[model samples]
Target chain A: MRFDLIDHAMAVTGAIIRVLVYSILTLPAILVVMSSFTNGETMSFPPTGFSLRWYRAAFENDLFMTALWTSTYLAVLVAIIALAIGFSAAFAINRFSFRGKAFLQGLAFSPLIVPAVVLGIGLLQLFAWLDLTQTIYPLLLGHLVLAIPYVVRTILASLTLHDQQLEQAAMNLRATPLRVIRRITLPLILPGLLSAAIFAFVTSFGNVTVSAFLTYGGRVTLPVQIFAYLDTSSDPLVAAVSSLMIVVTMVVILAIERLIGTERLA
Target chain B: MLAPMIILLTGFLVVPVLGLLRSSFLSGNHLLEGSGFSLEQYFHFFSDSYYTSVLVETFFDGLVVSLICVVIGFPTGYSLARLPPLARRWRMIIVIMPLTLSLVVVVFGWLIILGRNGLLNSLFVSLGIFASPKILLFSRPAVLIVLVQQFLPFMILSVMSVVTQIDPVLEQAAANLRANRFATFRKVIIPLAVPGILVGFNLVFVLSVSAFITPRLIGGSRVAMLGSLIYERIMAELNWPSGAAMAFVLFVSGLGFTAALNALAASRFIVRGRRHAL
Candidate 1:
């Protein structure tokens, strides 16, 4: 009875410790947003006042607006391009019994593991060799490299979950491959496509290490802007910009959740 | 269709990374400027304690953070697996939220949370836990906290997928055979769960080791890691060769660690399979 009692106490203690650690881990970003309410000169805890002026500053600031648009534009372009490539590759790998299928799959997935900094460096070097330094094309290509793996992974997972019999049935019915894909496979994998696209968007939008290296002053993305802004000034402006970005990100996440119901995403 | 992807992968990823390896070999005082290579950069990396320390730090950070993720993620993973099908849908949202969110946003969130005048300080003040705001940000502990938070979902989902594959009846059988719940968990559940746990460890470790932005923004200059060192060498100093060397070292070390773990996993899997076959 004493041993059982001791075990129960130990388990409870472990649970409490786990809870405290998890809560502490989740608190940092939330607290930063709350700290922005401080009307003081520097960021201070337990703000003397609460107002949304910093949020107002983030919107009104032209640089922030430019960076936001840049990030959004790049994100959208990256999604479209990545979807085109990733989907095609996924289709080819899934449908065909080709040589080097595993190798191709590994290649497709390698970008996810390869450090962003390495990708950034390699692309920077590649583009420089091609004389495309600090260009939008390089940034686009870099973002696509990062985004492709996510799209491929999500699409592959979806493809695996789906029935092969449907495609085989379509083939037996004398349907052309293109027609069958359009009429059968596309609809089945639309959820995956949607999920993949969301991932592509987020990957491109939130990229830093790769985007940071690729971006110049004229075409700085939101993260680069945030990094630069934080470096230059440790003020409420950065807090506001970060908060604004977070809100935008949260809205997109919520929208995706609403659209597909987050199960499809998982 | 795969041709284009294959070509892109070969040209951009495989070749460039290979080129980085070659670049690490070439010396400034070389026989040939373009082609002839020496072991100068590798020697530099190995010989210099400053750069070497960064490698060690990176490895340890990856180790600590991934382990923490496993510890935190296991129960969450179990809870998720046991959830009703309806509630299981929301579990992905919770799981992928951090994964999909921009690293900038995550690091920013950490900055806010761990910053001097951040959330914890205010909470502590209110609760009378601290007399004043404390400096928690930029510390090594803060990096682990932020990283574990960021990677926990990955670890959880990885384990949960495997856990769900397990038959609950095995647990019931164990119980029926006079085992307590804890004994059932230990004997029946844990062995089945090891593969998932190892996978989660590999994924999180790979991520944490190569991570630059997180360690940079949250950790400050005090917490030097290989990724950040490479960044400084390349971006700050424009020392591409040295930066490439550091990146190559990090890449090699990461590859080695994953390979070792995977070999360990494969052998263990075979052993388990043999036992089951028996």
Candidate 2:
């Protein structure tokens, strides 16, 4: 009887701890979402009289709109480029065993270990030395480096679980290698590819560290713009912009969840 | 097939880093100055008391935050592993939701919560814990709090992955052998969980040490970390060589620390035929 009672107490303690930790994890995003709806000019908690004025303000601000446009197109280009490289690389790494394969794999994943700030500064120097700092190429290239690892990781997971027998069966039917890949392998890994694209998109879109170094003239990414704005001012427009980002992130996350299931993602 | 990735990585990632490394030895403000190589930048870093203290504090902060993540993450992970599949799936989404959001947005949330007359202060004051709202932002503790929040998901996921693989049958066998719950946990579960804990520790340490946004915003100008310091030197001061030296130092220390932990973990645990745990 005493043992059962102790077990019950322990279970309760564990449950409480889990709840607390989850709350702490979600609290920040929740607060940002809540305050973004404020009617007042300044941001305040227990927000005063809910309104969408700040969202309007965020949209009306040309600087933020330009940043949003820049971030969108930049992220799209990064996703497409990263997918091309990541898909080919993941396919090769997954299918073949050759000399220097391990070295190649490590090199591909190496960016994850390197600090983003280090990457930013190094790229900044490289671009400046090459006289390419004035163009948008630096941001694209920098974000591609940041996004490729994620794309490769997601696609590799999918490829590992893929059935090679299907590809072999298709090839045995006299299909060419390209046809077999297009008809069998590509179709099979479509979900993984979608998830990988989302990963690349989110990574490039949300990046600030590397983009901070690479943003030239007025072509800043949305997150970097927000960072700069926050450094100078405190207002509800920042909250509105942050909430929109959170919404976009949540939508992408949900889309990924729908495609691959959150279990594989987590 | 692998040509494009290799070429891109070598050109953009590898070459740029090498360029930065080469410039670190040069004595010039601008990167293209072609000045003669010297050890002046590294010497300046070591000779300066401020830079040295910042380096020490960065490592110290990383250790403290990683330790806290392990302490808090272990229990949560254990519970998560024991959860039913349906419950676990929904909860996993919640766990990863914050991770999907931009770090800047997350920091903004913290800014509101920890700001003067913000959620924390207002709540505390309403409860008479203090006569007035205390200044909570732009401090070391605030930086630590945000860092832990930012990186805790990685720790939880790492621990959960390992804990989920530990069979429940072992625990049942221990109980059948007359072991108590705590004894079963200590002897069976903890030994199996060490690899996961080490991985989580290494990850959190590396990430927190390299973190820039949280320390910059929450800690503000009051706190100086290696990430912010490197940014200041390179971006604000235009001291590319000095910044490159600091970046190299940060990279080498992170690599060395991770390698040391892996070696220690491998020698102590994996060599005893538990290699599969990692």
Candidate number achieving the greatest TM-score relative to the actual structure: 2
Each prediction's TM-score versus the true structure: 0.90, 0.96
Residues B31-100 of candidate 2 have per-residue lDDT tens digits of 4587678998899999999989999999999999999998788889888888898888778878888777
Over B1-278, each residue of candidate 1 has an lDDT whose tens digit, in order, gives 77667666777777767766666676663221366667788898899888788788889999999988877788777666777878777556556666666677677767666677766787897899999888887778888778888888778877888888898888777767777656656667777888888878888998888887777888888888788878877788877777777788887789899889889877877687568536
lDDT of 2 at A73: 96
- The alpha-carbon root-mean-square deviation between model 2 and the true structure, to one decimal in Å, is 2.2
lDDT of 1: 0.76
TM-score of 1: 0.90
Best model number under DockQ:
2
Expressed as tens digits, the lDDT of each residue in A95-115 for candidate 2 is 889999888888988887888
- Chain B TM per candidate, please? 0.92, 0.93
Candidate 2: TM-score?
0.96
